[model samples]
Target chain A: MIRSIRSQAQFYYGGLVVALVSLILVGFNYYERFGRLKTLDERLDEQLTIARPLMFRGPEERPPPRREERGEDLRRPEKRKPPPPDRFDPLPKLRKEIEVARFREGPQGEEVLASLIRDGFYVLGFKPNGEELFRSENAPDAVVPWVNKRDRAKKRDRDSFQRWSGDFREAIQFGQGRGYLLVGTDASRLHEGLNELMLKLSLVCFALTGVVLAIGWILMGKALRPIDQITKVAQSICEGDSNRRIDTDSIRNELGPLGRILNTTFDRLVRSVQQQIRITADASHELRTPVSVILADCDLALRKESSSERKQETIELCRDTALHMKSLIESLTQMARWDSSSDVLKKEKCDLGQIAEQTAKMFTPLAEEKNVEIIIETTPCETFCDPLAIKQTLANLISNAIHYNKPSGKVTIRTKRIGKSNIIEVEDTGFGISSQDLPKIFERFYRIDKAREIEEGHSGLGLSISKAIVEAHGGSIEAYSQKGIGSRFVIQLP
Target chain B: MKILIVEDNQRLRRSMLEYARAEGCVADAASDGEEGLYKALNWDYDLILLDVMMPKIDGWEMLRRIRERKTTPVIMVTARAQIDDRVRGLDEGADDYLVKPFEMRELMARIRANTRRVENNPQPCLEAGDIMVNTVKRLAYFKDQAVELTAREYNLLEMFMYKRNEVLSREFIYDHLFDERDETVSNMLEVYVYKLRSKFGKDSIQTRRGLGYVFMPES
Candidate 1:
C-alpha cells in the first residue's frame, strides 16, 4: 500500500526475510528431530537383540564380577551389590531378574517377567532355524515371520529398518545372522524434543527477521534520498524560483541518469518559455511603430495653420500606414496559426516545376518594378506535397530574393529530383547576406536591414512562416550566401 | 531647441521629426544609428533624442560615442520601458529617458526641459540684459513689454541669449536657425540678426569685427 519507493522496497525485503528465516528454522527442526529419533531407534535395536537373549538364558555363573579387586570371592560374606544400571549392559540385570522369577519354569513366571519389562515397547526375536526365541505379550505375533519373508524376498540376510507414523508411531528393525529383532519405540519422546526445538527456532527467527527489516529500511532510505532533493528543487521552481535545478552531481546511483535527464529537460523548457516571452515583447514593440506613425500623421493634420494640401497628404499617409499595419497583423496571425500546432498543412500530389513557374509569374510585376529578372528552370519534377503551402513558401523565397537583390539582378527558381528527393532552389544575384547574418535569416523578426524592411511593410515573419510550412511537409530549408555574390535558399522534400 | 532624432523605424522617425518641427523647434532626423551618431557629433544641437534599438549602432553606442567627443544632452527613446533599461540609460550618461509610442506633447515638454539646461537655467524664459525670450511660447519680452518678431528673428535672439557672452559664427547661427530641410540664402542669417538688433537697439548686438556677433549689452 505504500507508494514511496523506499518504503515499498523495505516492506518487500522485510517479508522475504521473515519467510526465508522461518522456512530455514522449520527445516532444521525437522532434520534434527528425524536424526535424533533414528539414532535412538538403532541403539535400542542393538540393546534389545543382545539383552533379550541374556534374559531368556536366566543366569551365567562363569562371568566374574567386574568390581572384584581381591582374589578371594566370598559370595555370602559381603552384601550383594545392587544390579548395575541397565543401559551399558542390561543383560546381567535382566538375567538375574528372570532367574529369580524362574521365567523358564512355567507360564506364570513368563507373565511376571513380561510385565516387569513392558516399559512402553514391544519386542520379538527369532533364531536362524526359524524358531521364535522370545516374544513379549504385546509383541506383534507375525513380526519374526514377516521379517523372514521380507529377507527372503529381498534375497539378502542383513539388518533392515522401517518406521511407521500416526497412532502407531514407532520403528521396526530386523537382525543379524543369529536372529531377528522387532522393536516399537513409543515415539512420543522424539515428538516432544521436536516441539521444543521449533519453539526455540521461532524465537531466534523472529529476532533475525526484525534485524533484517531494519537494515533494509535504512539501505532503501539511503538509495532514495536523492529523490527528495529533486522534489524540493522542483517545488521551488513551481513556486517561481524558475532557475532552480537539481544537483545531479551528488547523485551516484540509478537515479543519477534520471536526475540528469530531468535537469536537461527543465533547462530546455525554461529557455523556450523565455524565448516565447521575448518574442511577444518584440512583436508588441514592432506594432508600436505603425501606431506611432498613424498618431503622428493625425497630429500633423490637426494643426490649424496647416493647409488643405497638407491635411490631404496626411490622410493618404494614414491610410497607407493603416494598410501596412493590417498586413503586419495578417503576417503575425499566419505565424501564430502556425505556432499553435494544428493548422499545419494539407498534402496532395503537385508538380514542383509548374508551381515554381506559377509563383514566378505571380512575382513578375514586383520583379519588373525592381528590375530583377525571374528565371525558372525545371526538370518536370513531380512530388507529393501540399500545393498551396508549397506555393506560399516559394512566394516568400522569391519575394525575399527580389527585395534583397540589386537592380537588374537575376532570381533563378529551379526544381529537380535527386534520388527520391525533390530539391527546390531559389538563388538570387542580390546583395547577399553577410556571413554573420546567414544563420539567423529564418528567425522570426530578425532582419539584416531592419530599417528598410520595416518601412517596406515587411513584418519579418515571412521566412519563419516559410520554414514552418516546408518542414510541415517533411522537408528542410537551408541557406547559403556569400556576401558580395548572392544568396541561395534550398528546400529539400521527401 | 534643435534636437536630433536617431531612430531606426522610419515612420516613427518621420512622425517625431514632423511633430518637433511643427512645435517650432528645429529638428533633424536620422534613420539609423550610424547616421545619427555622425550628425550628432558634427552638429551643435541643444538636445539629442535617441531611440535605443537601431540597426547599425544602437542608442547606447551612439550615446557613448557622443560623450567621448562632447557633453551633449541625450534623451534615450525606446519601446523598452523597463526600469533596468531606464537606469542603464541614465547611468550611461543619458540626460533623460522616453518610452516609444509616447505622446508628442510629453516628448516636447521633456525636450524643452533639457534645452533649458543648455541655457544654464531651469525655467521656461531665458534672459540676457533687458531682453527675455519664453522658449515655450516662442515669445519675446523687452523690459516686460512684448516685442513682435518673425520666427527666425526670435530663434536667432534666443540663441544669442543662451550663448550670451560668447561670439557666434555666421555658419553656427544659420545651422541652428534652420534644419537640414531648410534652403537658405547666404544673407538670410544676417537679415534675421539685423532685424533683431533694430528692435533691441544697436548697442545690444555687437558685431565682433568680421568674426561674428555678440549679445553683450552694457550691464
Candidate 2:
C-alpha cells in the first residue's frame, strides 16, 4: 500500500512539472512572435512616413491634422479573390503608382526609382507621374508642388525642413535614398499567422512533455515492482507467518539484507519451537508411565482379596511411584529455574569426584544384582560447578550404565585430573550403540531401539539431561561405543 | 479394638479395612467425609483411619471433630505423600499420618503405636477366667500362678483383651504377629491359638470352628 502511494505521488508531481515547463515554453514562443510582428509594423510605418512628401508634397499633408481636421477619404481596397493554386506566385500584394521620394529630397532620382521598383516598392517619380500619384480627390489637399528658387528657400536655419531637404537631396546623389508608399499588402496577416503557428508548436511541445512524464511514472512503477512484492512478504512475516519467505531472486540489492535477516530469525524460532515440543512430550511421557503403574497396581489391589503382604506390596509400590513422581516434578522445577537463571552456578565451588562416588554407591545393589562390579577409580578432584547438577549428571549416567550393562559385566567409573581439567568416565560392558544412532543420542526422547535393550522402558532422557547439565557446568560430554562391545561416556569439566 | 476407616476411594478403603482386620481390629468403614464424621462423632472406636480426600466432610475435618468429641486416636491414610500434607494432617488433630499404599505390616505397626497411647486407662488387673494379667508388669497370672509369656504372646493377649467378646479371624492373627516373610498361607494363627489355649485353658479361648477364635472373658 505504501509503495503504490509513493509511486502515485511521483507520477502526479512529475506530470505537473513537465506540463508547467511546456506552458512556459509556449508563452515564450508567443512573446517572441508578438515582438517580431510589432517591429515589422513599425518599419512599414517609417517607410510610409518617408514617402509622404512625394504623395502630399509637404508637412501640411499630415493625415487628420492631429486634431479637428477634415479626414482624407482613402478608399478601402476592393476584395480581390484569391489566385488559383496553379497560377499562384510567391509575391506580396501591391498597388500601382505608389509614391516615391525624388530630387525634392535627393538628386539621384533615376537610380532611386530603379531600386525602388525592383524591391517590390512602386517608386513613381514626381516629374513623370506626380499628378497620377495624387489624382485622387480625397488625398490631403495641402500637398503642393516643390518650389525651385527663393520660394523653396524659406528658412536658412539648419534644422529647418528647407535646409534638411537640400541635405537629403545631396545625400541621395551619393547613393542614399528615402522610402516609398507601401500599398495594400498582407504582411500583418502573415505576421499574425506566424504567431499562431508558434503558439500551436508550443502547445504540442507541452503535450509531448506530458506524454513523457506519464511514461516516466509508469516505468518507475514497473522498476519498483519487486519492492512491492518484498513489502507484502514483509508484512505477512510481521503478522506471524514467520515461514513466509521472500522468493525474489533479485538478491543483488537491499532486499537481500532484509530477506537474510528474516530467514535467520525464523530459523531460530523454528529450532526453539521444536525443542519446546520435544521437552513437553518427553516430560509427559515420563509422567504417564509412573502414573499408569500406580493406577494399575491400586486397581488390582482394590478389586481382589489382597493378603496383608499383597496389600502391603501394592501400597509400597504406590509409595515408590509417588515418590518418583515427586522427584521428577522437583527436577523439572529445578531445570526450569536453572534455565531462567544459569548464572547462579558461578557462585560456588565443589568436589565432583566425591559426588560421583556417592551417586555410584546409590545403585550398588542394582549393579550387584547382575553380578556386575562397579569400580569407582578416581583421584581427588574439585571444580567450580553446581554440586547438585553434577550429582544429577553422574547419577543419570551411572544409572544408564547399570541399566544397560550385561550380567557379570564390570562397570568402571573413573575420575582423573587431565591437564588442568576434571575428567569423568563411566564405562560399562553393555550392548553398545550403532554408529548411525550416535549423532542423535543426546536428543530428548531419542531412545536407542528399546527392544534391543534388556531393560524395559528405559527413558531416553538420561543422556540428554546429562548433556544439558554438563553443558550448564561449562563442561562437555561425549560417548563412544561399538555394537556387541561396551559403551563409554566421558565428561570434561573446566 | 473397633476401628473406623474414613477413606473415599472404595478400593483403598476396603484394602485398609482388610489391613486393619488382619491386624486383629474390628474395623468398620465409611466411604465419605459425612459418613466418616457421623461414625466418628457417635461411635466409640480405638482408632479412626481417615483419608484426606472425601465427599462432604474430609479427613481433616472428621479428625478435628473426632478429636473434639472423644479424643480418639485418628490416623490419616492418604495417597498424597507430600510432607507438607502429612504435617498438615497431623496438625489438624490426627494422631499420626501414614502415606497410603503403605505396607500392611507398617499400617498395623502404626495403628498399634497410635492405639497404645490411648489405652493408658488404668486397669490394675486384666483377667480372663483363671488367667489374671497384670497390665503394669506385662505379666500373665494363670491358675493363681504367674505364667511367663514372650513379647509376641503378650501382644497377642493384649489384642485379645481389647476385643474379648468378638471372634478374631486367623488372617487377623498372623498379620500383627509375623513380618512380611512369614508364610501366611500356613495355619500359623491356629498353631498360636492352640498354644495359648493349652497354657491358659481351652475354655478361656473359645474356638468358633470355621470363623475364628474368640476370647470369652468371665463377667
Candidate 3:
C-alpha cells in the first residue's frame, strides 16, 4: 500500500481519503446521538402533559414540597403554584443534562458524548429548579422542553427555587418551541494531522526523485565511456595515424567486433604507407648517385683538353643521366599524387594508333644510331583510357627494349583491336627477364636479382606503375621472356 | 685582344681564363660583380666576361651601370643550363650567354665571337646625316670638324645609324644595348637614348608611337 501510494499524487489522494472519512464518520455519530436525545425529550413531554391537570385540579391537593425547598421539619403543602407569568425564557424548560446522562449509558456512547462535547453545546433556557432545555453540542439541535417558574425579586430566599416563568406560557401559545439542531464533529484537529502527513510525504518524494535522476545520469555516462574512447581511436585513424590501435581490453559488448575491424584496417594501411615511403626514399637515394656522377664527369671533361672528340661523349652521358633523373622525379611525383587521392586509372578517349606512332618515332632515332631494324604494325585503334598513362607505359617498355638491345637488333611494336579491347605488344631482341623476376616485376621496387648488379639507375618502380596504370584503365600487362632471347610485353585495354 | 673575366667561382673562372689565354687574348679576372664592374668601367676592353649569378650586385646590374658610361661588350655565364636562362642573359645587355660547367672550347668561341663585333662593327660608318664615323681610327668627323663622342653616346648613335628607317621596339633596342641581365632597360635605355639624342640632335632618333624610336635619314 505504501509503495503504491509512494508517488506525490497517490500520497495526496490517500491523505484526502483519510481526512474525508474521519469527517463523515464523526459527523454521522454525532447526528445519531442527537436523534436519541430528541426522542427522549418527546417521551418526557408526554408524561409532563399527563401530570399537569391532576396537579392543577383546585390547589387543595398540593404536591409535596420540593426536596430542594423544604427540609425534614416541614409538612408537605402542595398547591399548584400558579404557573408564573411570562418573563425570562432563553430556552424552554427541557432537562438537557438528564438526556445526556441517559444517552451515555449505551456502548460507545461515551465516545460519542466526548466528540459532541469537543464540538461544544449551548443552553437555551434554565431555572433555579435546576432544569434546563439546551441544544446538543454541535449547536443546531432542536428538542427543547418548556416549564413554569416564579419571577419575584423578593423570592430571593436562597432556598426558594428560581424557575423559567415564560417558557411554558410561550410553548402553550406557540404550540412548540423552534430552534436549530447542529450536528457535526470538530474538523480542525483531524484536518491538521492530515495536512502534516501530506507535506512530509511530498518533501521526501521530491528528494528521492532528485537522487534517482542524478544516479541515472551518472550511470549513463559511465556506461558510454568505453564507446567514447573507441570513437576517439577511430578518429585518430581517420587523421592518418595508421599505427593507432583500439584498447581491446576496455572494449566490450558490440565494440569488440569494431576494435578487430579497426586493427585489420590499420594493419593494411601501415603496410601500404610503409611501401610508398620506402619506394620514394630508395628512388631519391638512387637518383643522387647518378646525378653526382654526371656532375663529376662533366667537371673533369671541362678540366681536361678541349678535344672536340671526347666532348660529344661527355655531353651525351650528361644528357642521358639528366633524362634518367627526370623520369625518376616524375615517377616519385606520380606516386605522391596517388597517395594523396585514389590510384584508380584515369580514363579518356585516346587514339592508340597515334600513340603507337609517336612511341615508334621517338625510339626510331635511337634505333638508327644502333644500326637496328625497327618496325611498327598497328590498326587505327582508338580506346577510352588515360592517354598520358598509356603513353608512359608504352614508352617504358619500348625504351627498355632499345636500351638493352644489341647492334643490328630488331624491335617491333604492334597494336590491334580484338573484340571490344585494344591490345599492344612490344617485342625486342634483347637480354630477357629471368624466370625468378617475372612474377615480382609488378611489385613496387622489386628489381631482378641478376639485373641489379648490371643496371645501376633503375628504381624498379616503372613496371609497377605501368601495371597500376593498366589495371586502373581496366587493362592488363604481361611479360614473356627467356634469358639470352628476346622479351615481349603485352598490354590489353578494354 | 683584351678580355675581362668576371665570374665568382674561382675554379671555373681560372679554367676559362686559361682557355682565353690560350686563344692569344690578355685575360684579366675579377672574382665578383662589384670588382668586375669597377674593372670594366675604368678600363677599355674588347670583351667582358660576366657571371649572371654573382653576389654583391649581380652581373646584370653591373652591366647596366657599366653601360651607363661605357659600351664594352659583355658575355654572361650561368649555372642553370635552361634555354630561358640563356635568353634572359642575352636580353640583359649580354652579347652572348654560356652555361657553366661549360665546355672550355664553347666559352672560347663565344668570347671570340663577341670581341669580334666590338672590334669590328663600330668602325668606318662614315655618314649619319653630315657626320662620318672613321673606321681606321676611333674618331668622329661632323661637317669636317672633329666631333668627339663619349663611348655610351657613340654606341647609342651607332644603333640608330644601323637601322636607319625601321622602328626598333624598346625591348629589341634595350636588348641590343644592355643584353638580357640588365633588366632596368625600360628606364635606363630611355635615359641613355635621350642623352645620345640631345648630343647628336633632338630629331636624330624619331619616336614612333606604339612602336619604338626610328633613326630617320633626312630625304
Candidate 4:
C-alpha cells in the first residue's frame, strides 16, 4: 500500500536492523543477569567463612565428650546434664565474636561490611538447639525462623543460602558444624545497571535505524533516478512527442541497456508513423487525379452548343477515366490489405512453371503490341504455395516488363529447382532500371518513370504488392538491374 | 494565347487540353513531367499547366528547370492540396496552384489569370488599335459596336490581335484554331481570315503576299 519506493525501502531495512539489535540486547541481558547471580552467591560464601569462627566454641577449650554421656543425655532428654555448671553457652560467645570481627578487620573490610549492611544485606547465626543464636540488626524478619529449621537439617560443615526477596540475593550457610549463618545482598543495583545498559543500547539501535533508513531512502532515489527519467520520456512520447528520447549516455549499469532498447523502439515507432502519413498522402493524390479527369470530362460534355461528336468524345474520356479510377482504387485496397498484414496466403501445391507460363501467355498480346517476344522455360519445378498469389506476382512482373520494354525486346520467364527451394526468374530485355532507382523499385508508389507509368495506366503499386504476396508465401523477390542492359526479377520459395 | 498542359494522367491531360481549346487557347499537352519539361524549355508558351507528380521529373523539378531559363507564367495543377504543396509550388516560381478534383471553371480562370499576368493585361480582352476582342465573352467590337463572328473567326481574330503587326502563317492559324481531333482542309484558315476581315473591315487584315496574313491596324 505504500506507494513511495523510498518509504518501502526504509521500512524493510529499518525493520531488519531493529529485529537483530533487539535479539542481541535480549541475549546480553540474560548473560549479565546470570553472572550477577553467580557473583552474589560467591560473595555470600566468603561472608559466611568470616563469620564461621565466631559462631562455634573453640575445640581445645572442652574435653571430648564421652560417647555414652552424649547417648544417655539424648535418652534422658530434659533431665540429663543441664549443661555442666561451668559449661560455656555459645550464643553470647557467637555474638561477641561477630562484634569483634566486625570491629577488628582492616578499614577496607570494615567499610565493605558497613556498606553491605547499609545496602540491606544481613547475617544470622542459628544454634544446634534449633534456635536463632544471633541476628544482625539489618537482617530480614523471616531469616531467624527460616535459618533455624534449615540449620538443623544441614548435614555439612559449610553450605550456602539461595533465596530472593524483592531486590536481594539471600543465602543460609553453616560452618565448622557450629551454626548456620544467613546472608543477603542487594542485587537491585546490578539489575538496574543491566536495565540501564539495555535502555541505552535500545536507544542507540533506534537512532542507528533512523540514520540508516534516511540514508537508504536517499540512496535508493539516487539509484532509481534513471528509471524515473525513462518513465518521463515514455510519458512524453505517449502524449505525442514522438521525438523525445531518454539520454542514455548519462545512465550506467542495468538501466543503460534498458534505455537504449526503449530508444530503438521509439525510433521505429516514429518511422512507421511517418511512413503511414506518406502512404495516405500518396493514396489520396493518386485517387483524386482520376476523379478530376472524370469530372472535367463530364463538365466539358455538358457544355452548351457543343457538337454531338465532341460530347461523345468527352463521354468516352469520362468512361476511360472511370475505369482507370476503379483500377487505381483496387490497387490501393490491395496495398491496404498488405499494410495491415491481414492477407493470409492460401497455400496449395502447384507448379511454378505452369503459373509462369500462364501469366506470360496472358501478357503475350500486350507484348506483341510492342513486338516484344515472350519466352518460357520450365524444369517441372513443383512447390507449395498460394497459386493465385504466385500467378498474380508473376503477372505483375511480366506486365511491368512489357510496359517498360522497347519494340522487339525479349521477356523470358524461367522456373527451376535449386536444393530445397524453387526459383522463378523473369528476365527482360526492356529498358532496365538505373542502379539508383533499382533499390527503391519495390517501395509503394515508387516509380522510376512516372510518365511512362501514367501513360500505361500503371498504379506503381504492382511491384510492391507482388513483393508482399511473395513474402507472405514464405518467399523473397529480388531484382538485379543495369542502367541500360536489362533487369532480372528472381523469386525464391521454400 | 498558347498554353501548355503537362499532366501525368492521360485522361486528365486530354480533358485539360480539350478545356483549353474550348476556351479558344492554343494548348499543347504532355502526358508526363519529362515531356512537359522538354516542351516547356524548348518553346515559348503564354502559360503552362504543370502537374506535381510525373514520370522522369516531377512538376517541382520541371518548374525549377523552366525558371532557370524562361519566365513563362506557370499554373500548377495537382492532386496534392496540402498547404505545404501549395506553398512549395508558389515558392518554386509557379504563378498559381489548382488542386485536383477542382472545378474545370476554376482551372480555366487560373489559366486566364496567369496568361493575363504574363501579358500585363488584367482584362480578358485582346486589342489591336480600335478592335477589341473580349475573350471571356467570345465577342468582338469595333468602335464600341459588337461585331458578329463565328467561334473560329473570333479565335482567328484573337490570335491576330495577340500578335498584331506580325505575320502569322496559314499553318499557324490552323494549328491554333483547330483541335488535333478535327480534320480540316489546308484552305480552312483562309475562310476564317476572310470572314474576320469582312466583319471588322478590310484594312484591319493585311495580306503578306506568299508569307501569311498580318493584322496591321491603320493609324
Candidate 5:
C-alpha cells in the first residue's frame, strides 16, 4: 500500500513524540529512585552514629551489686532498685546524674556493654583479639556471621562503616584496633516502592503514545482533505472532461493556490477544445465553395459538345477553381499551425514604421487600379516581434483597406508609439461595416460582401489569420467601423 | 426568351451566359446583386437566374425586392445545396432552384421549363404552320421532314417560330442573338436571316420596307 503524505507525517511525528515522552519518563523514574536511595542512606548514617559510642566502651568499670542489696523479691523488679542498676551502668539512662565517684571502671566492659545492648538497636561489638564481645537481640542472622567474618579478615579502617546487605540494609563500623560494630535495617520496602513506580511509569508511557498517535491521525486527515479533493478533480480532468475544475472555495490552507492553478489549466483546456471545433467547421465551409465551383465547371464542360476553344475555357475555369481550393487549404493549414503551436513566433527587434512602409508600397499598384490612394506616415517606432508574422498582418490589413474602399478613396498606414506599446494603424475611406456585422468581421468564412469577396478570389480567411498571427506575437488587433464612412484597424505590440 | 443571370462567380456567370445563348435564349448577366436587381427591375425578362450569395445585395434580398412588384419567374442558382437554404429560396419566391456544380444541361432544361411555364405553353414543341420546332431537341421539321441546322440557325428559327406573325426588328434580333461582350458586325442579322430564308423558303418571310421581317406562314 502506498502511504499518503498524511500517514507518513503521522508516523514520524508520533514516533518523535512517543520517544520523547518515554525518555522523560525514564529520566523522572531514575531521579525519584536516586533521591529515595540517598535519603535512606542518610538515615542509616545517623542511626550508625548514635550507636557507635555505645559499642566501643569497655565493660569492667562497674560491677553488679550483691543479691541482698536488691532487698526485695525479684518479682518486684520495677519497684525495687532502679538506683542499684544505675550504679552499675556506665552509659546509663540518667547519664547526666551519674557523678564520676559513683561510676567505676571495669577490666572488661561486659556489664556496661550489656546494659547498652538493652536499648532497642540491633548492634554487635567485636574485641581486638577477634573474639565476639556483645550482640543485641533482634539483629538479623546474617549480621553476626558477617561481623565475625569481618573481624577475621582483619582489614579494618577506623571511623567508617563497612556496609553489607543480604535482603536487608546493614552497615558494620570498625573502631581503631577494636572489633566491628554492625548496624542493619530492612531495605525491601524501598525496593518494593521503586518497582511499583516503574510499573506505573510504563503504563503511562504506553497510554501517552496511544493518545498521541490517535490525535496525530485525526489532525493529519483533516489537513489533507483539501489535497485529496484536488487530486480527484485533477484525475477527472485528465480523463478528458476538460470542463472539470477544482472548487477553489472549498479548498483551504496552502492547497488553495494549487486548486486555482488547476482551474486555470482547465479553462485553457476548454478554450482549446472549442477553438478546434470552430476551426474544423470553418475549414469545411471554406473548402466547400471552391470544390463546388470546380465540380460545376467540369460537369458543365463534360455535358456540352462545344468547340475546342470553349472546352479549353471550361478546363481553365476548373484549373482556376483548383488553385483557389489550394490557396484555401494552405490558409487553413497555416491557421492550424498557429493554433497548435502558439509559440512559433521568433521575436526580433524590428521597426514597425519600416514594416508599415513596405506593406503600403506593396499595395500601391492594387490601390491605383481601384483609383484609391495609399498613404504612409511613420514615426520610426521600434519594437521586438516576429517580423514575418507582423509583415503578413500588415499586408492583410492594407489589402483589405484597398479592397473595401470606394473609388478615389484614401488608405492610410501609420505607425507610432503610444505609452509602452508600438501601434500600427490602417485607416481606410472604404465602405465600412455596419454595427451588426462589425463584431463578426474577424471570423473565418465571414464575408460582408460575399459577391465582391468571391470575385476577388478571397477565401474570407485573411482577417482571421491576421488576428491569430497578431495574438501569437503578444499583440492585439481591433477594428472600428461605421457604415458608409470607413474602417480603421489598429494593432498594438509590446 | 430573355433572361437575367445574377451570379457572383465570374467564370460561372460567363459559362451560364454562354449556355443560355446556345439554348436559343437571350441572356444578360451582372456580377453582383445590386447590379442584377437594377437590371432585373428595369427589364421584362421571361426568367431570372439568381445566385444566393452575392455582394452589395444578396440574391435573397434581391428576390424579395423583385417579388414585391414583379412576378417574373426566378431560378435560384447557388453553391449552398443545404435543405434549409433550398426551402428558404423556394419560400422566398423562387420558381426553381439549381445547385452549383450543376450540369449546364440541367440549367438549360430548367430555363426552358420556366420560360415555357411563363408563356403558358406546356408542350416542348413550337409550331408555326408547317414548321414545327422541338425546343428540347433543337430540331426543326418542315411538313414531317427534319432539317439539320447550325445552333445559331436553329436559335433564329426557334425565335421566329415563337413569335410567328410579329415583326421582329433587325435591331431586336441582334440584341437577342448576341451577348453584351460579342462584337457584332451590322450584317450579321442579315446573314442569319438570309440563311433562314434559303432553308424555309423566301415566301415564308416578309420584310416591310423600312420595317423588319415577319414570319408569314399563310403567304
Candidate 6:
C-alpha cells in the first residue's frame, strides 16, 4: 500500500525477516530442549529399570502385594533401593509390570545415579505390607494423579509406563500384585532454557529487522537520488534555461531505459522549443513584407492624384502580394501539420520515375525558355508514397534547378531503385548553394541570394516544404552543391 | 531630407522608398547589410532605416560598424519584438526600434521623430525669423501667408531654415538634397536660390562668396 518503493520493500521484507528469524529461533530452541530432555528421560528410565530388581527384599514368601495396587503408593514415603530378583518371572507374565530404569556400567554408574538423584531425579518403592520400603534422599510422597500408558505386549503389564500429570514427566510401575516403584526426572530447566532463548531471539529479530529497514532506506535513497536531480533540471529548463540538462553520466537505475533516455528527451524538447521560436519569428518576418506591400499598394491606390495606370499597377501588386501571403500561409500550415504528425502522408504504392516524368513535363516550358536542357533518365522506381506530395517535391527541386541554372545548363532528373530503397535525384548544372548556405537551405524561410530571391517572390519555403513532405513519407532528403559548379538533391524513400 | 532604407525584403524596401519619395524626401535602398553598410559609410544620409536580419551582414554588425564612424540616426525595423531585443538595439547605438507589421503611419512618424531629434528640433514646427515651416505637412508660411512651394524647393528651404545661421557648402547641399537616382543639374542651386529670393527677400539667403549661402530672414 505504500506509494514509495523503498517504504514498501522495507515494510514487507522486514516482516519476512522477522517471521523467518522467529521461526528458526523457536525451532532451534525447541530442538535443543527436546534432545537434552530426551537424553535425561532415557537415562532415568534405564536407572529405574536397573534398580527395579533390587526393590523386593523377599521375592514371593508373602502373598501377592496387591494391597497398594490402586492408589496406596502415594500414602507411603519416598524410597530408593535395589529391588529383589524376579522370582516370579515364570509366574503368569500377565500379572507383571515394567517401567523404565537406567544406570551406567562400572563404578561410575553409581556416581551417575547419585548425581541424577541429586539433580531432582527420584526413585521410590512400596512394601508388600503397605509401608515405605526404601526411598531416594530427594524423593517425596505427595499424592499424585498419574497418566498411564498401558503396555501393548502379549504380557499386558510388561511395558506399563506412567508419568505424573504435571510437567515433571515422572513415571512409576510395579510387578504383579507387588508395590509399584517410581522413577522421574525434573525437566523444568529445559523449559527455562528454551524460554530464555526465545527472549533473546525475539530481541535479535527486532534489532535485525530495524537494521535491515535502515539499510534498505539508505540504499534505496542512493538508488533514487537521480530522480531528484532530474526533477531539478526539468524545473530549471522550465525557468527559461533550455540549455540546462540532466547530468546522465553519474546516474543509474533511471526512470526510463537509462538516464540517457531522459537526457535525450530533454534535448529533443529543447531543440523543438528553439525551432518553434525561430519558426514563429521567421514567419512573422516573412509575412511582414507582403503585408507592407499590400498596405502600400492600398495607400497608392487610394490617392486622388494617382493616375489610372498607377492605380492599375497598385491593384496588380496588391493581388500578387495577396497570392504570396496565401502561399506562405499554405506552406506554414503544411509545416504545422507535419510537425504535429506525418499522418498526412496518405501513402500509396507508386513509381517515383513516373512522378518525375510528370513533374518534368510540367516544367518543360520554363526550362526551354531558360535554354536549359531537361533530361529524365528514369527506371521503374517502385515505392510507397503520397503521389501528389512526391510530385510537388520533385517539382520544387526541378524548378530550383532551372531557376538557378546557367543559360545552357543541363538539368537531369533521375529515379531508380537502389538496394531496398527508392532513390530520386535531381542534379543541375546551376549556380549551386555555397557551403555555408547549404545546411541552412532546408530551414524555413532561408534564402541564399537574398536580393534575387526576394525579387522573384520566392518565399524560401520550397526546399523546406519539399523536405517536410519527403520526410513525412519516412524518407530523407539531402543536398550537395558546389558554389558555381552544380547542385544535386537526393531523396531516399524506404 | 535624404534617407537610406536597408532591408532584405525587396518589396518592403521598394514600397517604403516610394512612400518616402511621396512624402517629399529623396530616398535610396540597399538589399542587405553589406551593401547598406557600404552606402552608409560613404554617404551622409539624414536617417537610415535598418532591418535586423539580412543575408550577408546583420543589422547589429552594421550598426556596430556604422557607430564607429557615423552617428546617422538609425531606426531598427525588425520582427524581433522582444523587449530585450529592443533594449539591445538601443544599447547598440540605434536611434529607434520599430517592430515589423507596424503601421506605415507609425513608421513614418517614428522616422520623423528621429530625424527631428537629429536636426535638434523635436517639434514638427520650425520658425526662423518670419518664416515658419511645418515639416510634417511640408508646408511653409511667410508673414501669415501660406507659401506654395514644390517638394524640392520646400526641401531646400527647410534645410536652410534648419541650418539657418550656418553657411552650407554647395557640395553639402547637393549631396544632402539629391538621391543617387536624381538627375543633378550643375546650376540647380542657383535656380532654387533665385526662386526662393523672389518669394522671400534677397536678405533671406545671402551668399558668402566662396563660402556658401546662409539664410538671414528677419521677423
The TM-scores of chain A alone, one per candidate, are: 0.53, 0.48, 0.50, 0.64, 0.66, 0.62
Question: What is the lDDT of every predicted structure here?
Answer: 0.78, 0.63, 0.62, 0.77, 0.77, 0.79
lDDT of 6 by residue, A1-494 (tens): 67877788877878788788878887888788778777766776776665555453223433343435534565677562445765666543323322112222335445655765766777666644445545666665562422233322322434336443356665555544566566776667768877887788788777877887788889988998888888898888889988887777677564545657767888878777776876677678678777777785666567676689878887888887888778887877767666655777778899888989999999999999999999999998887789998888999999999999999999999998888999999999998888988999998888778668656667788888899888888889999999899999999999
DockQ of each: 0.39, 0.02, 0.01, 0.49, 0.24, 0.38
Best by TM-score: 6
lDDT tens digits by residue: candidate 4, A1-494: 78777767667777787788888888888998898778877887776555444454332433345546556554554654444553478777667567645543547445645665675667666765558765666876764344435444553333455766666676765443455556776677888888898899888877987787788878888888998999999999999999999999999769999999999999978877876786777778777877887788877778786789988887777676677667777888787666655246677788888888888899878888879999989778788888888888899998888777778889999999999989999999877998889899998878776645655578889999999988887789999988777899999988
DockQ of candidate 2 against the true complex = 0.02
Put down candidate 2 lDDT per residue, A356-422, tens digits, no spaces.
8888898898888877889999777877887877887888888778777788888889998888899
TM-score of each: 0.64, 0.39, 0.39, 0.65, 0.55, 0.67
User: Top lDDT: which candidate number?
Assistant: 6
Q: Ten consecutive residues with minimal summed lDDT in candidate 2 chain A?
A: A167-176
Interface RMSD of each: 1.6, 11.2, 12.2, 1.7, 2.8, 2.2
What candidate 6 gets wrong by more than 4 Å, as runs, is A1-3, A27-190, A197-271, A295-318, A332-350, A364-389, A404-452, A464-494, B6-8, B22-44, B51-72, B76-94, B97-99, B122-157, B168-213, B217-219
| Model 1 Cα lDDT, one tens digit per residue, B9-82 | 77668778877887877899998889998999899888899988888788888999999998989998888777
On residues A213-279, what C-alpha lDDT tens digit does candidate 1 reach at each position? 7887888788889999999988888787889999988999999999899888888777767757765
TM-score winner, 2 or 6: 6
Q: Which structure is stronger by lDDT: 3 or 6?
A: 6
Model 2: residues with Cα > 4 Å off, grouped in runs:
A1-6, A30-34, A37-211, A214-219, A228-244, A294-441, A446-459, A468-476, A481-487, A491-494, B1-219
Order of the predicted models by lDDT, top scorer first: 6, 1, 4, 5, 2, 3
The clash count for each model shown is 0, 5, 26, 4, 13, 27
Docking quality level of the chain pair in candidate 4: acceptable
